[model samples]
Target: KYQRAATCLTKDREALLAFYDFPADHWDHLRTSNPIESVFVTVRHRTVRTKGALSQKTARLMVYKLVQAAAKGWRRLKGANQLPMVTEGVKFTDGVIDAKNRAA
Candidate 1:
């Protein structure tokens, strides 16, 4: 089902297809990045709700506070009940922070 949907998007959505710059680098990770982009989208959405075009300072403040508050609970869940890291294919660094030192 996912393959069929991706094929359809590749054929139809020019905007979405432009995201596939390096097809080799973690396609599933790229898909996960999409939701992060929505945070910026939410900022744009709130910005346009103003009666006139927002002042630069005002826009920056709005985005800053929104992102800060959004990040509040984000970190707590990440390290909680964490599982062992799994690497795949050419990126099998076995959770090593410094890739150069790993037995690749």
Candidate 2:
């Protein structure tokens, strides 16, 4: 959303420092729930491309197999420890290491 919704802040240092002194949660980056949902949508599209009806039990097994493969792929992505995509666009004067530092 940051790439698309570029918000510009007009506050000076005094006001900006006062605002960020409050505590904020940092859980958004650690969650994988949305990424998994995106993977599911892609897989569903692929599965539906060449499909036919099946017995209820067979359908369940097919879904399990497909999801097992997906889970394995998700595990392989655990090494991606880069910073989350920046939102609100942090501006740097100099020596800012991360977004939090610049925002402060």
lDDT of each: 0.53, 0.50
For model 2, residues 1-104, the per-residue Cα lDDT tens digits are 66433333343555555433322222332444766796787568656974853777876777777777777655434323322422434432222235665446
True-vs-predicted CA distance for residue 67, candidate 1, Å: 1.3
Off by over 4 Å in 1: 1-31, 52-54, 73-104
Error of 2 at 82 (Å): 20
Off by over 4 Å in 2: 1-32, 76-104
Give the TM-scores of the predictions, in the order they appear: 0.39, 0.38
- Screening candidate 2 with a backbone cut-off below 3 angstroms (N, C-alpha, C), the clashing residue pairs are none
What is candidate 1's lDDT per residue for 1-104, written digit by digit as tens?
59998898878886665444323233445457655776777767776786544588886788898777666644332322212322232222222223642454
